[model samples]
Target: MARKYQRANRMNWLMPVLFALPLLCLAGAALLLWGDQLRDLINIAVKLAVIS
Candidate 1:
């Protein structure tokens, strides 16, 4: 019973981290692939801010 409880607790912690790791990787890949576009967006935003 204690072992099961401990395993359940471990799974509760592990599950979210396991799921989030892939999400983090996807975000990193997106940044690497689209960084130039993101940079352009930032520049446009800066220009708009300056104009305002």
Candidate 2:
């Protein structure tokens, strides 16, 4: 019982980080994949803003 309690205590701190890791990875992957397109979009927006 004591071991189980200790294990749960460890997991309580770890669980949220473990759950969030995949989401962080997915966002990183998306940024890598779409980086060029995003850069182009930002440049266009900047140009338009400057013109207007």
Q: Against the true structure, whose TM-score is highest?
A: 2
Off by over 4 Å in 1: 1-13
lDDT, candidate 1, equals 0.92
Write model 2 residue lDDT over 11-44, tens digit each, in one string.
8888889999999999999999998999999999
TM-score, structure 1 vs. true: 0.55
For model 2 the TM-score comes to 0.67
Q: Candidate 1 clash total?
A: 0
For model 2, the stretches where C-alpha displacement exceeds 4 angstroms are 1-8
Alpha-carbon lDDT, every model: 0.92, 0.93
lDDT of 2: 0.93
